[model samples]
Target: MSAFGTLLWLEFRKQGTFAMGMLMVVAGWSLLLRQFFAWGAEPSIVALAVVASTLMLAGAVVTAYLLWLGLDFAREYRNGRWALLLGAPQPGWLHLSARLLFACGVLTLFAAGMWGTLAFWLGRVGLEWPLGLGLALWAYGLGGVALVVPVLFIGLLVAAYLPARADLLAFLVGLLGLGQLLEWSLRLFSAQFYRWLPPWGLPLPRLGEMAWEGFPGLPSEAFVLLVLLCVLLFSAMSRLWQEVEV
Candidate 1:
């Protein structure tokens, strides 16, 4: 196999256990949420709203997974595994790209397992798959990706630049928590200002609201802007990785 293929395979191997654990968590959560809503007599608007809320929760799960993966990489760096991998005869960008691909692959699997479980439960409730469950799943998956890419990029940056793994993990948690606090403060105190601000201004609101109409969707210009942001962040992260001591 080619070098990139080999590295990609290695990345998958490293992540296998964690990925399985996450899949189990997603499955369990999906089943639990389904049971919570299934106690009702029939499907209602509230059920659809619950599905929407679940999608947002799924996005948070995916983001947390990505953060965990990035921190794992940082831990590997501290233990010299990352430097050993960098010693290989391949460009740094190729290695980073392979990691990105691995993340995308794992995320796709996660989304499938999560939405598939949800769909199964919806079917048990007599909902149509294509019209109701499938469409929502697709929207949720797309929105989740749109929400996760920038976070993954940020996590990569933290892992590459932060000298200590503990600091990297703490920074990730604080960053996410601060974003949520800011979003809540903004929404609570200044509704008009929140409406005027861009969709991506705060993480929680961005992830929660962007899946809806009148907010950023995967096909909209906002998504293109997010793609550009990811590219820029990834470039900066790659450069930092090259220059950092670890």
Candidate 2:
């Protein structure tokens, strides 16, 4: 295998079990929610839409995965594994890239599983899949990924910069709290004010709502801008990793 491939495979081996455990938690919650919707009183379309939006815009689920992967990288750094990897032939960017790619793959799978559960619930409740929910779910999942890129990147930064595991945990908590504050602030501000701000004002709930409202294709402009931001963040992270004192 190539260096990048080897690094990616090692990352998967280290984090795959934890990733699976997180997936199982999501699956269990999904099943319970499905049963509640199934056995509980009949739900209106609005209620269903609200629930669907909430499921797609689940920040907690995304944050949990981010923290898991972030701590894994931090653990490597603290345990001297990161220094050993740096001794290898490949550049530091390749190492960071491998972790980022692995994170993207894991998050895509997480979105898929969450969407599949939502679809299953919709099907059991006598809703058609393709015509009723499939396209919207696809759009939401893609948008969700776009929403997650920066977040995961931020997590990586925290892990790489902070020395202690407890510090990493505290940073993540503060980060999540700050994100929630920004989200709320965006909502509270005027639409005109939001338009004046950067794309960060456009939160996941808005993206999910657009999907639910049948906006076609990917949110192309937002996705492209986010991809660019991820690239910038990745470059910065690579530089930081190289400069860190062991």
Candidate 3:
């Protein structure tokens, strides 16, 4: 395998147990919806149940993946493996790119799968395509990665600076959990305040409002903005990594 492939594969191996657990959780949710249908409901009620179940699945999957990505970055830093990898033959950007690909690929799969299931269920409910939901879901998943990338970067920096109170691993993981708190607080602020920021300002409103009709979905300009922001933040992160002292 190439360097990128090797790194991604290693990360994938580490994630197998978590992935299996999530799969079981999804299966259980599917069973619960099935149970609701078996309880003898009208078609309309069944359709409602399915939509509710699908939304629940999407919410859980997104939250879990974000937390997992944050924790994973912190764990690598705590173990000193991040520094070790950076010292190796691979470039820092390559290493980070691999990690980002792994994160985005896994979370995107979960998000897409949940929405695909929803699309199937809606079809059964006699609903048609262009329900104007799928693109919003896709953008939300991509935009989510864009938002979390900086969190992971900042979490690693914080972990490196903090003292080893408990195990480094424990402290690092806890630092990553701090991202969830950051996310919650950001939601409390209005977008009018946040839009000045690059990444969070872009995704937050679209994800919350499901407004696929405007800049993000319809206009190619939004796509350009998203790409530019990702590149800028990623470059800043690389510079920080390079400047970190051993």
Candidate 4:
């Protein structure tokens, strides 16, 4: 395998089990949801149940992945693997990229799966959600998930460099500060910068009376700004990664 591939494999070897377990739990929840749907007498009620359940699932998955992402590097500090990675010839970005890619890939799978699952359940109830809308939602969700990776990675690095026990507090504080900065930056984008950029609208299939006509699209600059912000955060993370002792 190539060096990047090797790093990806190493990440899998470290956290693959947890990822698999998480997937299984989601699968089990899907089955349970199916069973619950079968119990609903009203079509509208069952459809509402499906929508609410899907949202709940999405929120749970996001939260779980957040913890998982933070732990990806934090766990290494305790398990003696940190020394091995510090000794490797790979650059710090390679290591960070591998984890970021892995985590993002997992969430992508999750979003796709949930979208398909909702389509299936909704089909059974004679309601159809648009593919365009699903894709839009998936992109929006995955973007949120992917963007936080840099913050979490930096938090892990901060925690690792601190004394034990105290590290937890340091990590949370770092995340809070970074998160606040991100919020402020986004506010600025919304207040002034967003208007300067073109609107990136979603194209929905016209289903006659069922078509959505008035949903405003997001500014293209919102996405560009997010990408730039993540790049900045990841760059800072790379610099901090080298400071961790072997």
Candidate 5:
């Protein structure tokens, strides 16, 4: 197998297990909530739960990605594997691309599993399955870049700069989680304001809400702006990664 292929497998092997464990946890909580709470049967409530749970699951995946990348890179650097790889004929972008592909694949699985679970629950509730599923996945995909970019920036910084990989990963994860908590708190105060910010605060899809009604669907101008923002983020991340110390 190629080096990239081997790296991908190792990443999947580690992350797939975590994804399975997350699935079980989400399933158990969903089942329990359905059995105990009448509110869980309400479409809006259930949809919100689904969204929140999926977001949390996605966050867990991001956390895992950051942790693994940080640790793996740190180990490689410590053991001089990084130097070996650099000495090889392989391009720097190849290593970076392999890592990016691993991240995208893992994140896609997490997003798919969450949307699938949401579809099943919506089906049980007699809601329109396709719309619900489509909206769930589309919104998650659109919003994912915001979260991924920040996580990537922090992860690379920690991996390449920090002397203590474990401590840095722990601190970064805690900081990310804290940011989410603050976002949730702010949303409780005013969702409109939250929608104006990045990460959790950005406007994404609304399953039943119509775009013409000026809901979470981005306006034409804002959509263009968001695309630009994504481009800028990608460029910035690429530059940072290139400059990252071993």
Candidate 6:
């Protein structure tokens, strides 16, 4: 396999088991919730439970996974594996991208799973689950979660270069600044001119022949800015990786 491919395989092997375990936990909880809903429990209540449980359980699991990945960059002492990888010919972007891509793939599966699980129970009650809108909303929420990978990674890179006792403080500062970067980027890009850009225009799931109006689909402008931000963050991360002392 090529170098990037090797990194991805290793990452998959290292983290795949955890991913599968978390998936099972999510699926198992979903099944239990489904049973509860089947017991003539209120659909509204059951749906709320599904949302809460999935967010608390699966969300934490994924957060922990990404935090672990990001924290690796901040370690003061090199493990044998880190030692070997740093010695390899790969660029820092390759390593970071491998992890980012894997996490994104896992996150997408998770978003889909959450939507599916919710839809499964919702369908039993003759409710219309808006597939397009539901998935888009999930993407928006979970995409925020995914954005944290670069933030944490970037924060830790700054921390690694700071005095030992000040590392946490530095990371906190970086976290605040990097977060504003996202917020301001959104503010800057969400201008009226941006509205002129093409929108995703995905169809809303019909509610039993009820017509809906004025539903703005996903904004292509925001999507463009997000992609640009990701590229900028990734480039910063790769540069900091080179400059950061192990």
Q: What is the C-alpha lDDT of each candidate?
A: 0.61, 0.59, 0.63, 0.72, 0.56, 0.68
Each candidate's number of clashing pairs is 0, 0, 0, 0, 0, 0
Tell me, by lDDT, which candidate is best: 4
Candidate 4 residue lDDT tens string, 104-169 = 777777777777777777777777776777777766776766556565566656646565557767
- Superposition error at 14 for model 3 (Å): 1.8
TM-score of every candidate relative to the true structure? 0.59, 0.59, 0.67, 0.76, 0.52, 0.72
Tens-digit lDDT string for candidate 6 (49-101):
66577667756776776676556544523454554554567887888789778
- Can you write out model 3's per-residue Cα lDDT over 1-246, one digit (the tens) per residue? 798889888878977667666666666665565665575776666766777767777777778777887787677767888668656767667777877787777766665666566666556545443434566666766777786756746654554554544346654664575556455545543334345545422232222223335444333334445576578668866765665544
Give candidate 4 misplaced runs (Cα > 4 Å).
147-153, 156-184, 199-222, 243-246
Candidate 1 lDDT (Cα, 0 to 1): 0.61
Candidate 4 Cα deviation (angstroms), residue 115: 1.1
Note the residue pairs that clash in candidate 3. none
- Write the residue-wise lDDT of candidate 5 on 134-227 in tens digits: 5445445545545555555455555455555575675577468647754664555364544555532233434465222533543333343445
Deviation in Å, model 4, residue 217 alpha carbon = 5.6
lDDT (Cα) of model 3: 0.63
lDDT of 1 by residue, 60-84 (tens): 7777876686577668757977666
Quote the positional error of residue 54 for candidate 1 in Å: 3.7
> Alpha carbon lDDT of residue 110, candidate 1?
75
CA lDDT of 238 in candidate 5? 63
* CA shift of 60, model 5, Å: 4.9
Which rank order by lDDT, best down to worst? Answer: 4, 6, 3, 1, 2, 5
After TM-score superposition, the amount by which residue 10's alpha carbon in candidate 1 deviates from its true location, in angstroms, is 1.7
Backbone collision tally, model 6: 0
Worst 10 residues of 2 by lDDT: 200-209
Q: Pick the candidate with the highest TM-score.
A: 4
